[model samples]
Every structure is written in structure tokens, then in C-alpha cells.
Target: MALRLDRRRLVMGGGLGLAALALPGGAALAKTLLSASGFTHGVASGEPGPDSLLLWSRYVPAGEADETRLDAEIALDPDFRQVAARGVVRTGAYRDWTVKITLDGLEPGQTYWYRFIGPDGSRSQTGRARTLPVGRAERFRIGLFSCSNLPMGWFNAYAHAAARDDVDLWLHVGDYVYEYGIGSYAADDRIAERVVLPAHDHEMVALADYRLRFACYRADPDLQALHAAAPMVCVWDDHESTNDSWEGGAQNHQPATEGDWSTRRAAAVQAYLEWMPISEEPWKSYPIGDLATLYRTESRLIGRTRQADIGAAYREGTEAALTAFRDGVWQDASATMLGSTQEAWLARELRANARTTAWQVVGMGTIMGRTVMPGDALDLLRPDLSEGAVRSFANAARAGRIGLPMWMDRWDGYPAARSRFLKAAQAADADLVMLSGDSHNAWAFSLSEDGRPAGVEFAGQAVTSNGMEKQLGVAPSVAARSFVAANPEMAWAQPSGRGYMMIDITPERVGGEWIFMETVKARTSAVAGAHRMTVEKGRRRFTA
Candidate 1:
């Protein structure tokens, strides 16, 4: 049976009683009890295909601890008067009361409203989902987002995007939910209003911890609204598990204190799958009709090796040591960003997509373009910066003096892997468009391999994390100009901003507009500013 009221009206009318849980402060207590019963964390949809998509929701009976069943339905309208599909799904504590149902046999290029119904007739907030077009897609816009640390501030970027009707899908490259505890990585001034749940005030390391963290993030109204607005394609970066995570361990994880790395990694992955509206596949591709082929690649846990220690090289205080590290460790041909198997699959996919599509877009976790900090840029560092941040900059500056890129965690550190990927694109003669997030700053890079233009990259800024402006003493404009001047491949840079990227794909070109929020410190979606850049088809670079 359909709920008589509209979904938006239901939420605005406080039918679900989540307004207090969505706010800050005392809401933390409500969040903690949310999982005990009822439909918690609004509905979401993802893993969209031409004829199918995955629906997700979390529900628990008030007095039941065992598995419970819920009825799922889809319709052409919010009122469900035109009911199109229906199914039943089971959820229990084993899966954290989260339910995911993959509904197939649906029409292509259509929008559907979906909701879950409890046994007692309670309904989940309606969620909107879309299926990929089968052919001749004139245009598709993806709202690109990442690095959303809740305690940092309001999710203004998400709120802004949720208010838009143009975005066809949401692509969160990584760091959807940070693993940090309260105050560990949040803005000091915003802690009172953006507090992490006290029960989860330590870095997440266990299954329960990760589940609680996801619950906390999902309780936010802005995030839930975004999920409800459209289907999302998401992947996890390091922070979803821990900071700077790789195949074996993470920079922030201490085996001595955090238990086994594999155990923690397993818990993180399990919680992610249960909470997110994604498939079990580590990587996958989406075909947007004949206009574009979007490949979501995995770059973390599956096959990434440990990041090279650039700081250690710099600490050696000798050009010889730095050169040795750069030549031997940093450029190790066998070290991979994406494991060998995924690399081969990506290459094959790129070639196949190029044969039929106008664009081959790769969405990954980190920036792919080379970003060597100019030695002179160090002069802009803020004196009040933490010692660790200063040291990191110093090392990067030292490497820059020798023409080495900083941030070994990025593609720059795995030079051979990057070269191989670029060569694959060049060999396929593909019109490549790379989308990335991880760095808190906005960037546009003209990618090249051996002086031959290979692709163009539009890396989005963080939704709320502090960017270079927080660490640098100079103004944002000066820092951006300095960065652009320092890196040849860099076409543009926004050193300071809290925003998301809007990527518009057409047969002729792909355009990206970075939309910055006026303030994350406040709960507002007023636009601060925006910058647009585009690459023409077959250009292999951003248009000048």
C-alpha cells in the first residue's frame, strides 16, 4: 500500500521524528539509540544499471533481536499511486539491521521512487533512483564529492547539491565517513555544534565501531537528503578504514594497539558494504549510453603497496639519499596503485570503451597528475602551523627542488603505474577524463605521458576539510597562482574552498564546474563562488 502523503512533506512534517536526530548536540543520544528499533537512516539507492538498481535501508523491530522482514516498493510518483515494483527483504543484527535489495527488470532511463515498509505499516522516507540510458544519452551530470569529515563543519556542499535538480547521479570517490574520533580532525570552533557521538569518540577499528560511525554520519540530514535525492556511486579511500591505508597496513593504524590489520580491514570493509548502497565488487564500470563510460577503480586495500617515505629521504639530509630513494623506492616498477589484475581489467575496459564511446572517464580516490611543490612555495607556509605539517611541507619542498613530486600517497609516488595507465589510454586513443578526490584543494591538470597529451583531470576539493589555505600564510589567490606557476601540468588551482564538482558529459565535451559553499561553519547552502573548465572531444587536454 502507498503512503498517502508526499515524501518531502513527510520529512518536513516530522513524520519520521528525525529532525532532532539530524541536528547537533543532544541529538547524539538519539543517534545512539536509533539502531535499537524502527527505520533508522533514510533510504538510499545505488549500483544503477540500464534495467536494475540496488535499494538500501536500515530497520529493526522494537522488541525483536532476530531477523525481520520488510516490504520494499517502487513507484512512478512519490505517492506510489503508480506502483511499479515490490519485494521483500530481510535484515538482522548480523547485517546491522541494514537491508539491500537489488531490483531488476525495470525500464531504462527512468526515475523511480522507492521506500521500505515495516510490518506495522511504517514507511521509510522515499528515495529517488535512476537507471542508465540504453542508447543516445545526450547529457548526464554527476555531482562529484569526497572527504566529508562531519565534525569539520556542516555538509553545505551536499545540501547545495541536494537542492539541485540537474545532477543525474552522485559520485563520492572516497572518504565518505572519516574514522577519526571527536576533535581529532575537526575544526575547533565547530565541535560544539558538530560533535561526533560520544560512544564513538575513538578512532574506529572494530566492526561495531565502524557501524556506529556510519550510523552517526547517516543521521545527518544533509547527507540523508543527498542520498534521497538520487542514486550514488561510491568507493572508499583510506579514511573509511583509517588514514593512508594500503594493502598491509595504514599510517594511523598501530598493530600493537589496534589488533591485526587484516581484522580491522575486514571489519571496515564489512561495515562499508552493509551501510553503503554499493555492490560487493571492488571496482566496476557504468556506461552512460554512448556518451561516456564511467569506470570506478579501486586504488586502496585491494592492491596498493606501502607509500614511499619521502620524509625519511629528506631527513637523510643529502642529495644522494633523496636521489636514491626517488630512483629506487619511489619509482619501483612493480609497486602498484591498482593491483595487477585490476590494472589489466582497466586497460582492457578502456580500449573497449574507446571503441564505442566518446569519453572514457576514470573515477578514483586520489589525484593522478604530478604535483611537485615548488621549493619557493614553502615561503607561504604559516608559522603557526603544526610541526608535522611544517615538516611535511619542508620534505615536499626539498623533493620539489630535485624535481620530485610530493605526496607519495598519490599517483606521483607510483610513477611506473601512472605511466602504464596513461600509455593504455594513449594506445586506445581514448578521450580520457579523470575524476579524483582526496586532496582538500581544487585542481585541474592536463595529463601527459612522455610529452604526449594523454588526458585531462578535474580533481574536486573537499566538502569541508581545510585546504592549503589553512596551512599557508598567503592569501588563497596568491597560493593558487604560485601552485599553478610551479606545476607545468596544472592548469588551474583553488587553494582554499569547501565544495564539490559538477561534471557534465556530452558527446562533444566534458565540463566541470567547482561550486564552493559560502560557509561550512554555518548551516547554509548560499554559494560562495564557482569555476568552470572543459575539455573538447579528441583534444586530450583542457581547452585553453
Candidate 2:
């Protein structure tokens, strides 16, 4: 049997939708002539807009010091026969030995290929790319994932997506890379606390350290394959900077041990932009015909206030945590998660999309809208929730009934911000759909305003990192069903599974499918469960 992609979408290479031809060598194949340190790292493209996309690659030159520009060529065909655009881009240490070139003047909804040539005649890999479709396009697809912790498991989810050639774009909603230096989150003797390439065993605090970490992650074959095949629109959640990060501080960040927050914060953002196949721009949007607008918003390290810690709720024991949460702090509008700036941006976009588009699609971190806990929707592992003594840390994630971490940590925590954004969607006369990560579980919910359903949310599961499964590993299936039975608003959720999500947006209705990994403990990427979730237009509700 042949190795297959999780989605079975991977097609063997060679000029997809275009003519196949051999690429011209600008010089001696430095891959042959420039030697080992050539473009060892490979190439990736991201942030596909209406007519352009950002192309990125890294090369370790052969010499000590010479400013050189790579003669880069991009075309609609693999053979470079139909060159859409060509240019010279400079790559150097200033940007951490990387090349960032924004290609322009191309037709919308087209597939393209790009390659880089160094001074010594070396070539980076032939990277694949595509543009968003033009006006009133009926349907488009997004491969969504989040919360990938390298030390925790293999990046099989990315690998699974890569083997399939179907998705037009990939949206990695945070935890693209973890900040924990190993052993911190995973309790293990063999996986010792990561001896970070940056001296410190705790958290990353410097540029070089941050760079090294990203480099190591980008080095993953699975992550590389996914980027190689699809254009990615990525957004950061807390883990990218620190655990449970807010405007002022973080759950894992310590000013004492890590020095100043701003410096560390900048270093994280800088490294992220430099290494990942994403732009340095904080937020952006991709216009998808007149059907909908994909609005990418910054949910962490920007305007998000300190996450609702609700220390009163979680003082150690799950029962105490439950008791405390029921007594107080589930809804505190005065305590803001998204500050004024981002809040305003989201509102305005919703209003604009509502006027003309069929749907307002908000791509972001953290679950949006409200989720009631202790209800069946939060079917965390009550039966054997303490399996391996792993408390329901991530169960509360998709819905969080145990730690109750200020449901505001998710959309539940920020009732006011959720209201403000949803109201904008309602006023825009637009059907709304929110794509979220950060919670690390699959969820489908209906968003309501003033007792009227306004939007629907489809939250993706983790790429690899452990989630509700950690707390309720004993009988995940039963727990999931129990949750659905309990939560009326929440149509469904998989508290203890890992996988990616796919969304198909059209004029009539918005549909979602959660593809659960067959098993994380195995190296092979396989789908455990493939579920269909649909939200009818104007109804603002999810159904099986």
C-alpha cells in the first residue's frame, strides 16, 4: 500500500493547472556549485491577497560578507514557461538570513511557482503558490489548525494536510510554535526540560534564542511540506509569545525571570515574522469573491487585556475550582479581553462585509461567542477525568467547566467584546462565521445577540499538542456524546481528539468538517473521525 495523506488530497507534483517545463539555472547549480550551505532550508509562500502573495526563503551564503540579491523568478508554470512576474530580491543577516519579496501584478485565483537564485548560482526549492479567486466566487477552502507543541508529538497533522493538494489556503491560528522549553508542559524523565538553544531552560527572552527555536520548528518535515504545498494565513495565540498572554502579562511569563515584557514580546513577534511563511504585518484580510471576507485579526499581545485569570476559581482541586467558578466571575464585562483598538477593527469589518457580502468570516485566535459550562456541552472526562492525574486542563479549553479560566480567556470570557463584534455582524446584515483556535478542541456553536442568533463559530482542534484528551483519556467517545447531550447551544465537540478542520464557504450556507487524527501516539497521520457541521444562512445555527 502507498503512503497516503490524511485527507487523501495530495497529488504527485509537476505544474498543477499549468504547463510543466524545466526551470532555467541562473548560474552553476550552487546546490551543485555553492555547496552545502545553499538554500538548505527550502522555501515557503504566505498571506495571499487579491493579486499578490509574500514569498519567503533562507540561504546561508558561502562567503564572509557580500551584499547579494537573488535573481528570483515566479511563474504560473513549473517550467517557468509562463513567467507572470520576475524580480531580484536581497537576502541577508539584517532579516535573519531570510528573503521576503511581495510579488504583484497577477490575475486573481491563479496558481504560481517560485524559485530563488543566489549569487554563487544556487537555487532554492521550487515552491508552489496560488492567489485568491475573483468576485462572487461560489466556494473556497481553508485548512485550519492550531496548538502544535513539538515535544508533545509529531507534526502529522501538517504532514496529513500537505499530502493533499485540495485546500486553497492554510490558516494556522496560533501555537504554530511553542514557547515552553520542553519538560515544562509535558511531564517526562526522557524529554528533559528543553535545554533551549538559548541557554535558559525556562522561556525564550532574546532574538537569537527565538530565532533558533523557530528555525528548529520550521525544520520539521511535516511543517515544511504543508507550507511547500499551500499558502498560509497565520495568527498568533498566547503560546506564540507566552502561555495565556494578555495585554500586560502572561500566565507563564515572569518579568522577574524573563526581564522586561516588551523586549521579550518584540523578540517573539520579530522571530515569528522572520522565520514563518507569514508577513510582519499584524493583521490583514483576504477578499474571497463577494461571498465572504476573511478577516484576520490579532487576538494576542496586541489589544487583548490580561486574560481573565479568575484565580479564585482554580486554586488547585477541580471541585474547588468548579465551586468557585459557579459562585463568581464567569461574566465580567468591565474586565476586557480585547481592548478598544482591535475591538473597533473587528466591528468595522463586520459592518462593511454585511453591506455587500454573503458572510463575514473572522479568522482569529481564541474561541468567540459564549459557551455554558457544567452543561452537557462541557462533557469533559468526569468519569475518569483525572486519568494519569491529568486534570481537565484542556477540556475547559473548548468549553472549560473545570478550571473555568474566565471563559473570557475564550469568547465566553469577553462577553462585551463578543457582543460588540457580533452586533457589528448583525448590523452589517451579514451572516457571520468565526474560525478559531487556541482552545485545542473541535467545537461548533451558535452566536446570538439580544436573544437572537447572529453568527456561528467552528473551532479547530490542535495540530499535535495534547488537549481534553489529557484530562479524559479513558473514554473520549462517551465524554464527547455526553457533552453534546448537555450543551444545547453547542451542537458538538471532541474534547479529547487531535486533528485539523476544513471550511467551505458559499452563498447559501457555511459548512465545516472536523477531521480528527486517527491517533497521536502513532507516527502516521490518519483521520479518526470526519464530521460535517453546517450553519444555515440567516439562521446563525449549527447542525449535523
Candidate 3:
């Protein structure tokens, strides 16, 4: 089914509402009009405030061009009838032909359109931007997305969300771009059209390589549309640098082949800052009027301890040995997703905003809810499976029987850290609503401590990455039922889906819907299904 978008119909209810209509054009349509040869990458705005936001664009000067100075315009109308703000900025080859301008003197909670002018008097494509609400707002909508792998499939989810007008702001939790080399993250026989940039076919390790990678991804029309449609808040996950990244190292990084971790990490960070329309702060929180407090946290690379190797724990041989390893070292308190410093900051933020904001939403990278392996996980396997698959399924089941977390990459591996964060939220008496994306699966969790409700989590599926069905070789419905059956805290789940989420917040409640697209293999706005969950104000729990 085609996406049902209402750009002009405003959502009015409780404390929040949906504003209809979004700027049109899917990826294919967008590509036909925008190019990378000149003002190739479309314009974007982000790091929004009540009165200001950053506008960005890339310009390639004409032959033997000496000057890099260009003019930017912000207007009330698409045709620039009402030029609200205008400024000139310079972009040299040093910064890869990209320029950013911070425009001020604008009203809060209002929509504006902007564009850039080249030295040759040519104009960039128009873009839309919105400022954060200052005081009381009727409602706010935030689009959540993650794990957009170009080689996996088309970015249909990004296209679908870009076509919706209800979304006031777009927040990409992480994995904005993959770091895998060619024929790495994707299937060996990947689709020809889905192949990634050949400029740096190998994994991104240096600053120039990372810059090229971002340039390649930014060239995408759907991604460009998402950025052009509204202001965005973003954070990078491990894949942005390398897989399972932490404070010290990463799973995908090999010092011998990749060089120093610190050097590579620095390159990734620099490239991200130069390309994205964001501020320099490692992490920050945003106030959406009195409705919600959105905390965008840096979950990977900053403070996280290295993720646990659950597979190693399972390889301990004897049943008793496996049981011992699973309980003892697996539950280490030192293992953290958020280091002590950030953890304290988060705790204080939760307490400080509890009294004012109706909802405390933490936009993070990984799944915070507990997701264990199914006890009968092996039963779903086919008889012709390889030995390695059987062994993995057996270990998964064994780990579940012993109450060990199946995936160390998520918060489940660091239960103590999660517990501390949840307890801190509970202590603050906060109405917590967690927004997470990384698992590539949709999940609704009712978080609790000591059998008492603590909060709720809305985990969005990947933009195109394969999910549980592909990972575990199970049917979508079967995976959903099994996940719910295995985890009491999980209210619902769709373990095999590729899409994003729409989170609507009001003073009275928080509403969310996981919008599943028909396919990412083909460029289409058709939707296959949607699952919705709601949490009443002050309840700290979602409706079943």
C-alpha cells in the first residue's frame, strides 16, 4: 500500500498532533533532478534551536575556479518571495567543497525553506527546515532511523519517511553509513545496482577515505530528501567507524591491517563533522516545548567498554564451565555501554527534566531491553544446515537456558549498566520513553525493576539491513511470536522487517508506529504493515 500522508491536516489531540504533507519525490525521481557534478548533493539543515539552525550544501567550482565564496538564502516561501535571512559563506577544496551557514533571527516552531547560490549565479535545490519549539507546543513528531546499508538494498524507508509531512524532525540514531569494504557486509552476489561507492572500495580507515564514503552516501537522493525535508539530529553507531566499536577498539578493526585505532577513529569523526549538518558536541539534549526532552547520546566509541564476546563464553566446553562463565564474567559491572561520566550526566538530566517535560526520551544506538535466545531455537533450523549453524543454534539455546544474553552487542550484555540507568530514571520519577535503533528489528518493551514498571522502549527496525528472519532463518511471524514468548518484558516484536519508526509525543501520551515497507530491494513507497504502541502520561509503561 502507498504511504498515507496528510501534509495540510494537522494532528490535534492530548498535547501533540501530526502535521500533514511532506516534500515529495522518491529516490529515483530525486536523482533525475539532482546531481553530484556541481551543486550535486542537495541542501540540508540541522542542529536546530528556537532561533537558529545550520544549513549545509556542497559546491564544485567551475574550471580553474579561484574563489569559493557563495551566497545562501532562507525564505518563508519556496520561490524566495520572502527572504528572511541571507548570508555568504566560503568553501575551499580543503573542506571538500562543502559549506555550512548558521542562520539566526527566526521564530521558534516555524517552518522555513533555504537554498544556496553558486559563484556562477546557479542556485542549489531548495530545502525545508524547522526550528525547535520554544514554549508550550501542541505536539511534535520525530522520525527515527538507523542501519542504512547501501549494498543491502534501496533506501525505500528513507524515501517513505521523506514523503511524510507529519515528521517535524528526523533523528538518525546511528549507522548512518556502513564502513565495510566491497563484498564485505552484503551478500557475495549482491545486486549490481546496490553496489556501493568504488572510490574507496576497501574499508574506510583514513580521513580522506571516510570523506569519500560520506560523499558517496550523501549523493543518495533518498538520504538527501530526508535531510532536505527537515532538520535532523544524529549520532554515529559502530558501523559508522567499524563494527562493535568501543572506547579502546572495535571488532572489525585489526591494528595490523587497519593501522592505529585512534588514528582511524579520528578520521571517522572528522569526516562525520564535516559532512553532517550537526554541532561539535559529542552528545546533547533537546527540549521539545513541555512535551518531551530528547537526549541524543553517543553510545559507541566514546565511553563504552568493549562488547562482550558471548561466543567465547559458550565455547567453554563443559556445561558447568559454560554456566559459570555466563553468570560470572558476563555480569561484570565494569562492562558499560555508557561510561561512568555520561551515565551520571544522563541520570542528572533525567532528574532535572522530570518535573518539567512530560516525556523523557533517550535517543540511543542499541537495544536497551532484554532479548534472550529462544530455548527451542534449534527446532526451527533445517536439517540440511551446516555444522556451524547447528553449533551456533545449540550455543544460543544453551545460553538462554542459563539466562545468558544472546547478543553482546546490545545492552543485554551489560545488564548492570542498564539496571543502573533504569533505576536512575525510576528514582527521578521520570516518565521515560526510549527511542533506539540498531537491532534491525522492531520491538516494544515494558521495562521494569524489581517487578515495578520503570519505562517503555520503542526500538525501530533497520532501514535496509536484514533482520532476525534472515539472521535466524525463521518466518517473520514465527520470529515475532518466539521473541515475545521468550521475553516477558517485551510486549510485542517484529524480528524480521526493514523500515523506520514514527514517534509522536504529546503532554498526555507518547504514540509510536513501526512502519514496515513493502520492499527495500526495489524503490517503492508501498507499505507492508505497521505496528503501533502507546504510553499514557506518567504511566512509564506502554499499552499491551
lDDT per model vs. reference? 0.85, 0.70, 0.80
Most lDDT-accurate candidate = 1
- Pairing residues by index, what is the TM-score of model 3? 0.90
TM-score of 2: 0.84
By descending lDDT, how would the candidates be arranged?
Answer: 1, 3, 2
Ranking of candidates on TM-score, top first: 1, 3, 2
What tens digits encode model 1's per-residue C-alpha lDDT throughout 1-544?
A: 1111122432312243323333454344434455456787888999999988899998878774588899999888889999888999988889989999998888889999999999889999999988998888999999999999877878989889998988789999999988887646534634444555433346898998888778768877788889999999997899999999999999999999889999999999999999999999999999989999998888999999998887777778888888888778887898899999999999999999999988999999999999998777668888788888887887788778777897888998899999999999999999999999999889999999999999999999999887778787888888888788889899999988899999999998999999999989877889989999999998988985
lDDT, candidate 2, 426-445, per-residue tens: 77777888899887788887
Over the full model, what C-alpha lDDT does candidate 1 score relative to the true structure?
A: 0.85
TM-score head-to-head 2 vs 3, winner: 3
Model 3, stretches more than 4 Å misplaced?
1-37, 64-67, 185-189, 199-201, 471-474
- Tens-digit per-residue lDDT, 64-125, candidate 3: 66448889999888999998899999987677777889999988888999999887888898
Error of 2 at 144 (Å): 0.4
